[model samples]
Target: MGVATQLVVALAIMCAVLLAVAFFLLPSRSNKRKGLIQIVVLGDLGRSPRMQYHALSIAKYGGHVDMIGYLESDPLPELKAHPNVNIIALPNSPRVLQTGSKLVFIVTAPLKVMLQAWSLWSVLAYKTEASEWMLIQNPPSIPTLLLAIIVCYFRKTKLVIDWHNFGYSILALKLGRNHPLVRFSKVYEQLLGKFATAHFAVTDAMGKVLRSDFAISSPVLSLHDRPAPLFVPLLPSERIAFLTQHELTAAEANEIIDGNTKLIVSSTSWTPDEDFSVLLKALCEYSTSAITDSPQLPELLVIITGKGPLKQHYINEIEALDAKQELEMVTIKTAWLSFEHYASLLGVADLGVSLHTSSSGVDLPMKVVDMFGAGIPVVGYSNFKAWSELVQENVNGKGFTDAEEMAGVLKSLFDPANNQLDVLREGALKESKRRWDSEWKPIAGRLFELTT
Candidate 1:
C-alpha cells in the first residue's frame, strides 16, 4: 500500500465522523412538532383538586394537554371547557385496598399493579412524539408511578411525579405501622421516586422528605395547592342569600347577626386521616362549658361539608345526638356539597376548622387554603411541620393537638367581645392574597421547562 492510498482512507474516515456528529447534534423532527403535555392521574380525577388545577394551569399557556384518570369523581367544568384540554375518562376500578382490610391490600398488590400498568400502558402506547411529558399524581396507588417510569423509559418521554403523600403512610392508617405491606410500600415509593425526571412536592416539608428518605437529587419543585378562582370573599347580601338558600330562615339569619347564633364550618373528605370525631368531640366540649354568662356565646350552627366512606357513620352519630335533643348549645348538620356551595359556605362562615393531621405527616391540607381564601380563620389539628405551614398559631389560624384544646380554641374565636376573630380573619385574607396571588401559572411554566 502506498502513502497516497493511506491518505484517501483517512479522509473518508474523517468525513464519516463529521456526518455522524451532524446527525446527532441536529434537532429531531419531534422537536419541530407542536409540543403537547400529558397528565396521567390514577386517582379519582373529579375529586382531586390538584389534578384539576394542574390541567387548568397547563391550559393557561395555550398548550395542548391530555388527562387520563379514573371516572369515580366528576371532571372539573373549567377543564372540560378548556379548548386545549382533552380529558380521557377510564372506568373506575374497585380499590380493594383503600376500602378493604390490610390482608386484602397485600393479597391484591400484584394484581393491582398489573391492572394499573396495563391501563397506563394502553394510553401511553399512543404517544408518538419524543420529548413529550406526563405529570403523574400519586399516593393511593404508588406503583402507578413505577408504571409511568417504565412507559417513559421506552417512549423517551419525560416523567414527573407530583408527590402529595407517601402511600405507605396512608396504608399504615389501616394496616399497623409494622405491617410488612406498609414497609414494602415505603421502600418501593422511595426507590421509584428517584427515577422521575422531576418531582413536585405539595409542601416544602414533603420536598425534604423526598430528599432525605428517597435520596432524590432530581429537580424537586414545591407546588402548593391554592384557592380556586371561585373562593373569593362574599358580599353581605351574598352571604345572607347563601345561608337562606341552605334553609336559614330570616329569623335565624337575624339571630346569627344579633349574636344569638353563630355558623361554624369545616370541610373534610371523611377519611381515616381526617378525624371528624375530633371536631365533634370539641363541639361537645364547647357545648358543655359555661365559659360565659351571656347567651351571646351564640347557639352554634355547625355545618360539616364533604362526602366520604365514613360520612354515614358521622351522620348517624349527629342524628343520635339530635335525637337526644339535650345539646341545645349546638346543632349539627352534614352536607356533601358541590365546590360552588362549599366555597360559598367558606365565604360566609365565621370560622373554619380542619381535622386533618396530614395522612403522610408531610402533605398540607387544601381545605385550609380555601378557608384562608374566603378570609375565614381556621383551627386545625397540628402535625407540626405540614399543618404548621398554614395554621401559624394565632396568625392566620390556630393549631390544636386534641379535642379539648380545639374546643378551647373554638370558644375563644366565638367570643363576641374579644375581637380576636376579626384580627384572625384579616390575617387569613392577607396571607391568602400573598400566597394564592402568585398563581400556579408560573409553577406550570417551570414544570413545562422540564420538557426542554
Candidate 2:
C-alpha cells in the first residue's frame, strides 16, 4: 500500500474509534426513564411566592410537571426551564357560559378545568405508564377542586393540597365569618383534609392551625418559605454598584456613609392593607421636621418598587404628601424581575419596610425574606405572630404595631452613634443561612419526595 493511502486509513480508523467511544459514554434512550411521578400544579402562575417556590423545587427535583395556571397580562421574565417541565397556560380571558340556571357552574367550571387538565394528563399518563399525582398549590376554585377530586377518584391518583395561606380565615376577615364564602371555604377545606393524601403548609404555625381548626386527617407537612438562593456573592463594591444602577449618584452613596441621607425602601405590590400611604405620611412628617438638638437628619428618600391595583392610589398619596420634592419617593413599576435581580435591589437598600394593619393577619411578605437574604434590616408592623417570631429570633429587624413605632424604629436604625447596624447585618446573614437549612431545605425535600 502507498504511504499516503495507509495514513488516510489510519486517520479514518482513529476517527471511527473516537466516535464509538463517545456513543458509549452518551446516555442511551433506554436509560432515560420517564419520570416516576407527574405533577399537575394549579394556581396563578404570575409572580407569586407559592408558585415560584413550588416551580423551582420541581425544576431542581426529578419530575414531569404540568403547570396549569393563569399567566399575568403583562410579560413576565422567563423562568429557568428543566427537561421535565411543561407549562400549560390557562385561559387568561374570562370564561362565559350561557345558562339561566344557577346550577350551570355545577356542570360548567369543573367540566372546563377537567377537560383542560385531561388533555395534558392523558398524554403524560399514556407515555409515563404511571399513576399521576395532582398537587393544588393554592386553593382551587370550588368548582375546579370538585373537578380535580372527581378526576383523582376516577384515576386512583394521589392528591396533595398545598395550603399557602389560611384562605378560610382570610375570607372570614374580609367578609364576616358568617358570610357564605367563608363557610363554604371551611367546608371545602375540611373536604380536602379528608380526601387529600398529603397537606403542605408554608409554616409550622400554619400546619398546626390546619390540623387543629380544620380537623384534617391527612399528615400535615411544613413547607416553610424558602426564597430562591443567592447565586452571586455580593461584595461591598457590587452592592454600591447596584445602588448606582438604580440611579443613586456617587454623592448619594457617600451620604449613606456620612449619615447625611437616609434611604427607606419598601419593595412590594402596593396593597391598601399594607398601608403604604401611612408610611408615606410618617416619612413626610419626619422629613419636614427640624432636627434642633439631634445630629443632622438624613435626607429621607423612599424608593417604592412595585405596582398593583392600588398603584394609582399610592401615587396619589405620594403626590399629596409632596414626597417628590422633600422625600424623593420614586416608584418603579418593575412588576416582573428575576429572583436574582430583585434580591440585588433589596441587598443595596438601607432599610426594608412592610406594614400590615390589624385587618391583615398571619401575612408573611416574601419581600421580608428577600430583605433577610440581602442582609438588610426590616422594619414593619408586628401584627402577625410569625412575623414577630422571625424578627425577634433573627435580631436582624424590628417590628411595631403602628406608624409611630415604625417611624421610631427607622430613626433608630439610621442613627450613626447606635453602631448596631453591624450587629444587625451579621445577625441577618446568620439568620438567612439558618432559615435556608431549617425551613427551606426540609420543605423542598418534601416537595421533591411528592414529585418523585
Candidate 3:
C-alpha cells in the first residue's frame, strides 16, 4: 500500500475506536445512578407536615434523601421505614411547648439560626455530593436560606425552596405588620427567593405572588398536600375494636353508631391565627336550636384535636360549657391524637369542621385535606384564596364567615331529613380520588425534574 493511503486508513481506525469508547462510557455513567437522585431536606422537618410529605415523595421515587430536621415527638415510622431515606434529627427543632415563651424565641432567633446553620454547614461540607440538591422549607425564612445560598454556592449544588408561607407574614402575626423586623423579612424573602434554582408553592395563588410580588425568576412548581393512604373507612370489625379499645360503654358506642349521633371533628395548632372559639359559639347555637322537640334530631358530639398556647383556655371553656349541661343535644370532647388514631377518627366521623382562617391569608389549612381524604364532609371558613379551591358551599362542603352563619351551616349539615351531608361526602370522595390519581402525582413529579 502507498504511504499516504496507509496513513489515512490508520487515522480513520483511531477515530472509530475513540467514538466507540465515548459511546460506551456515556451510558455506563448515566446508568450507574439507575435514575436515582440524591436529595437533602433542610427545614422544620418533624413538625412541618408539608416538609415530611416532600421527603416521602423523594424516597418513594427512588431518591436517596438525607433529611436534616428535628423530632418534636416520636419519629414518623413510615418515613423511618423507607430504605432510601435517612432522618438526621437536629437539636434545635423541638415542639412549641419546649420553646418557652414567644418573646424568648423571638429574642434568641438570630443565635438559634447561627447555631443551626453551623450544624447544617458541617453536614453539607462532609457528606453532600456535587449532584445532590438541598430542598429547603421556608418561613423561619432568612437564616436557613442565607446559609443554603452560602453552602450551595461553595458545593456547586442547586438549592430548591418549597415556600409554605412568608416568614415575614408570620412576624406580622406576632409583631404588627409595620414592625421593622417584618419589613426586613419581606425584603429578605424577596431577595433570597431569587437564589433558589427552583421554587415549589403549596398553592397556585402563592406561585403567582412569588412571580409578581417577590419577582422570583426561578422555575416555580405548585405541589399541594395529598391525603395519606391511611385515611380510609374502617371495616365493621375494626370500628368495633376501636370503640372497645377506647373503653367506650355499650350505650356510648350506640350513641356514636346505631344512634346516628352526628360526630363532628376539628383540628388546630391552637395558635392565635385560628379562632377556635368561633367553633365553640357555633356549637352553643347548635345545642340551643335542638330544643325544638324534634324526635328525629341526631345527638351531636364535637371532637377537637391538638395542643397549643390557648389549649388550656379552650379546655377550660369547654369544661365549663359541659358542666352547664345546657347543651342537651350536644357533647364535647378534645384530645391530642397520634396519626393512626387521628385517621381512625376521621374515618368514623360523620363530618369535619375547620376553624382555620389562615395565619396570613396565604396558605390553606391541612386539616381540611385530611377530612376530604376520609370521605367526610367539612364545614370550612373561607378566609383565603386557596380555601375557595377546596371548599364550595353545598358542594364538597359548606363555608361561612361568622359564628352565627357557621352555626346555621352546621345545623343544616347535621339535619336528619336533609341529604346535604351525604351529597357533600360523595363530592369529597370524588375530589379526594381525583386529587390522588390525576392532580398530585404530576405536580410532585416536578421535584424530580429539578435534578435533571
Candidate 4:
C-alpha cells in the first residue's frame, strides 16, 4: 500500500530470484541432463492420464522422464515404479483462490497466477533435470503456456504442447463467447501457441484448426488417446464381488449373480459439457418401456462414476426420479471411484454409455476410449462429427441423438432375441487390440529421436 512496503516486497522477490539462479549454477546442478524429457501439466498429474501415458511411453522406450505437476492423486503404479521416471510436483493453489465472492476473485486471481507461475518456474528452472524437450498439456493454458515459452527460451529446450482442447472455448462455457476474458484467452493462446516446437492434437479435427486457424508452423500430429495396458476385462469373481459390495442390494446381488440383470456403466465428470440429464431421462424411459417386453427384459444395473461441481445437483435429480418409482426397471448407483476401480468397473460392464457433447465439437471424450479398451461397446451421443472417429455405428459401438434413440438402442442391444450386444462385444474386443504404445511410438520416436 505504501512505497516502502512495495519496495520491500519487490526486493524480497528479487532476492528469491537471484538465489534460485545461484543455486542452479552450482556445479552439481549445472550439469543439465541430456536425453531427459520433461512432461508438464498444470492440472493434477494423477488425474491427467494422457500426460501420464506420455511419461510412461517415454520411460518404456528407454528415455528418462521428469513429470512436473500437482500430485493430487496417485498416478499409475507403472509410472511410479519406472526407473527412468522422476515426478516433480508443483505447489498446490494458493488459499486466496478458494474464495466464493466475485470481488475477491477479481482482486486475487492475478496474485494466485503469479504465485502459480513462480512455483512452475521453480520446478522448470531448478527442480527438473534440464532436457532438450518439454511436453505440456493445454486447456489450462493461461500462464502455463507463457511460462513454458519463457523457460524454454532461457534454457534452450524445445517446447511441445499437447492440445487437449481450446482453453478459450472452455472459458466461454461459463462466460459467454463475447466475454472479454474469453476473447483475451483466445488471443493469448493463439499468439503464444505458435511458439511450440511441436503440437499433439487429440483429434484430426483439432489438428486442422491449429494449422488453418492458429497458423502454427511447427509439426502438428494427431496423437489419439488409446487405452493403457491397465484396461482389461476384470475376472468374473472380482466383478461379482465388486458389484455385490458397492452397487447391489442383497436381492439385486443375487439377481446379478444369477445373470438376471444387465450391468451398464457410464463415466461422466458431471459438467455442463456432458448433459447427464439425457442419460437419466433415457434410462427412465427405457425402464418404463421394458416392463412389458416379450421374454421379460433383464433388469438394468447402471453405475455412474465421477465427481464435479454439478454432482449434488444431479444426485437430487436422481432422487426425484426414485421418488416417483419411475426407475423401477433400472437401479442407478453413483460413486466417485479411484482410477483403478474405474478401470475395473468398466472392464466388467455389459455396455458403456457416453453423453459427452464436446464444447468445441472437435474434442473427443477419453472416457469412451477407456470403455472401448475394456472390450465393451459404447452408445455415444452422435451429434458431434468427431464421434464417428471413435464410435462406429453398428460396429464396435453405436451412436444416438437423444433419449428416445438411446432407449431404443439399449432395448435392441440388450434384447436376448437379437443377440446385438454379443455382436458389439466381439467388435469391441477386436478394437481393443489397438493399444497406446503402438500409437505413441512413431510420433515419439520421431520427436525424441529414439529408435522404437
Candidate 5:
C-alpha cells in the first residue's frame, strides 16, 4: 500500500493497455501482415458472384485467400486457376433440408444450424491457419455470423460482413415478419452485425441503414457490385459460333440465326423474391403485343438461367404453354448455366430482364450488373429504391413493376424500327468499362496490403 507500490501497479496497467491497442489496430498500422483473408458463403460458390469477386480481388493483389462455400456449381475458370487462392468446399446440407415439408423444415432448422456450426468451427478453429481477416456473405447468416464472430475472436482476425441483403428479410418472405423465428433472426443479425470490424454494402442506401438503423459503429463502405473480366460483349462474328457450341440447342440457336427472332436473357435464383410469374405473364402479354399491337416488335427467344426451388414450377408452366402451342410470337427456354456460358449468353443476347424486386429494399442485384457489363440493356423490376442506382430508366436499362408494364418495355426495346435498343446497348457498353477490378483494387490494396 506504499506510494512506490502504487506507481509500480500503474506501470503494469499501462503496459497491459498498450498491448491491447496493438492487438486490435494491426490492420490500420504500418506493420500489417500479408492478408490471409477468408471469404465465406453458405450458398453455392458459383451462385455467389460477389464473394467470388472479393476472393479474386484479394488473390489478384498477392494476398492468400481461403474461399469457403458449397460447390453446388462451378465457379469462374480464373478462380480455379489462381495459385494464391485455395477454395475449401463446405459439407453439403442435410437431405431433409433440401427436400422437406414446411413442418419438417421447422423441426430441422436447429439441427441444420448445429451441423453447420460444427463444420465451420472445425475448419476455422483447427483446420485453417490463423488468418488476418474474413469477409463473409450475409443472408443465410444464422450460423455464418455466429461462427465467424467466435472464430475471429479466438484467432485475432478482423471480421467483415458484406451486406448483400438481410437474412431476416429473406426468411420473412416464407415466415411472416411477425413469426417468432423471423423476429429472432432480425435481433440476432443486428446484434452480431455490430461486432464486425467493417462492412461493405452493395449500395449506398444499405450503408446508411447499417449506421442509422442497425446502429453499426464500424466503418461501412459502399462497394457496389461490378462484373468480373469474364463478362464482356461477344463480337458480331462470334455470335453464330457461341450459339452452336454452348448451352442453346442447335435447333433453338438456328431459330434466331435464320430468323429475325431476338434473344432475350434473364438470370434468376427461381426463388419467391423473383416471381417468375412476372416474367411468364409478361411473355404472354408480349406475344399478344408483338403479334397484333406492335407488329414492329421482333419475334422473341427468351432464355431464363440459374437454378432454384421454383425453377421446375415455372418450367412446368412453360411446358404446358408449349403443349398447347397457343403462343407463337415468343418461345421460352431455361438453362442452369455456368459463369462462362452465362457471361457469353449475356454478351450475345439482345436484352436482359431481372425479376428481382429485392426482399430488402436497399439491395442492388448483381445480375443487373453482369448484364450491363456484358453490354446488354436490362429491364429490371423497380419496386425497390436501390434499383435506380444501377438501372437508369431509358439509359443503361428500364424498370417495370407489373407484367403488363414489363411487356410494354420489352415490346418497345425489341422493336426493330425504333433504334432504341442500339441506344441502350451503347449506354450499357459505357457502364461495362467500369469493371470490377478497378472498383475493387484501391480498397483491396489498402485493406490487404502487407505491412499496411
Candidate 6:
C-alpha cells in the first residue's frame, strides 16, 4: 500500500507543477492586441518649434504623447484637436515646491548625494512593470529631473534623456568655468548618463562632448531637428505676389523699401544670445551703400518677426543702426498659427536669414527647415557644423563669419543675372523632401515601434 500510494501521489504532484508552468509561460489572447506607448513631454507647450515637431511626429506615428508644462497666455490651437496628444498644465505652486526642494541638495551636498542614491533604490523597487520613460533635455527644473530618474529606476522603465544643449557648457560660458552650479550640473549629467538606458543628443558635436567628457556608455542617438513636412503644394507665383503686395500696401514696408523692394526676411525671437544686432548693422550698411551709389537701387526690405524679453533691446539696436527706416519689425505674440499661414509667409520671402554666434553651437533651427520647405534661400553664420553641412556654399545658402560677408552674400543673392535664386529654390525643395523621406520618416517608425 505504501509503494503504490507514494508513486501515484508523486505523479499527480509532477503533473500539477507542469500545468502551473504552462499557464505562466503560454501567451494569452490579450497579449496579441496592439500595444500602447504613452510619452510624457516635460516642457513648455507653446511657442516651441522643437516640441511642435516632436508632437507632429508622434501624432503621425500613432503614439500617445502627453506634454506637461506651464501654459502660455495664448494656447496653441493646433494642440487642441491633436488626436494622439494631451497637454497638461502644471500649477505655479509645483514649480515653487520643486525649486525649494533643490535648496536641500545645495546646502547639504554630500548628505544629499547619499539621500539621492537611497531614494533611487526605493523608487526602482516600485517600477518593475511600467513602460519606458524619456526625459527631454533642457528641463527648467533640475530637481524634477532628479525625481524623474528615481521614478524611472523603480518603474523598470527604460530611461531616455534627450540632450538639446549642455547646460553645464552654457553655464560655464555665461558665468566662469569654475562656477559651482556649472560643476554641479556636469556631475549630475554624468550621474544621469550612468543610470539612463539610452541618450539622444540634438547634435553630433554634443554627443561627442557627452561621450568624451562624461564617459557615458549608453547608446547615444542623434535626434537632430528636422523641419515639419509641408502638406501644401509649392505655389511660387502666389508667394511672390504676397510679398509684392505686402511691400506695396503696408506703410512700414513701403517706408523701408520705398516701393520696388528687394525682400529679405528673418524671423527669430531677438535674444541677446542670438546677435540679431549684427544682422541689423549689416542691413543698414548695405542700405547706406546702395543709396550713395545707385539712385535706382532696389529698396532693401528687411522683415523681422518674433518677440521675446530682449525685444526692446533689439528695437533699440535697430534704431541705433538707423535700420528702422529700412526694416519692418513684426512682433509675434500668439503661440500658434496654421501651417498654411506660416508657409505662405515664408514662401513670399525672397531670402531668409538665420545668424547666431559661437555660443549658439551647432543648432538645427526650425526656421532653417521652414526656409527649405518654403523654397527660400537662407544666409547665416557658419560657426555651427550642422548648419554648415546643410547650408551648402552657393547651394541652399551662404554662411558668413562677419556682418560684411553677410551683406556681400545678400547682395549677391539679389543679382538678377546670378539666377542663383532659381537654383536655390529647386535645391531647397529637394532638401525638404529629402529630410522628410529620411530623418522624419525614420522618427515616425521609431514612434510606431514604441506604440505598437
| Best-matching candidate per lDDT | 4
Clashing pairs in 5: 32-451
Cα lDDT tens digits for candidate 3, 95-214: 432454546555445445545655665555444444457778776675667767766675556688878778898778776787556787899899988999898887888989999999
Candidate 3: minimum summed lDDT over ten consecutive residues — where? 26-35
Which pairs clash (backbone N, Cα, C closer than 3 Å) in model 2? none
Deviation from truth (RMSD, Å), model 4: 5.0
lDDT at residue 134 of model 2 (Cα atoms): 66
Best-first order by lDDT:
4, 5, 1, 3, 2, 6
Between candidates 5 and 6, the TM-score winner: 5
Cα lDDT computed for each candidate against the true fold = 0.74, 0.57, 0.70, 0.82, 0.81, 0.56
State residue 357's C-alpha deviation in candidate 4, in Å: 1.2
Top-scoring candidate (TM-score)? 5
Over 121-180, each residue of candidate 6 has an lDDT whose tens digit, in order, gives 232233222434444455332444464565555444555666666656554554456756
TM-scores for all candidates? 0.86, 0.75, 0.83, 0.88, 0.90, 0.73
Of the pair 1 and 4, which is ahead by lDDT?
Answer: 4
Looking at candidate 2, the ten consecutive residues that score lowest on lDDT are 26-35
> Which pairs of residues clash in candidate 6, taking residues 3 or more apart in a chain or in different chains?
123-154, 124-153, 124-154, 127-154, 127-155, 127-156
Cα lDDT tens digits, model 4, 29-105, are: 33456788899998888888999999988887778999999997888888999999999888899664755454454
lDDT of 2 by residue, 1-452 (tens): 65533543464445446434543453322222334333444444655655655655555565566655655632123443555556655544345632323345323433444444444333333333334566776544343454455546655667777766655665454456775546766787666566877778766677777787778877888766645566223688887786666553344666654556665667765544577766765675555442434444566656676656577776776666563564442222223355556667677667777765533254467677767777777777777756764576327877777666665666666666786666777777665664443454465456546332
Model 1 lDDT-worst window of ten: 26-35
What are the per-model numbers of colliding residue pairs? 0, 0, 0, 0, 1, 6
The candidate with the higher lDDT, 1 or 3, is: 1
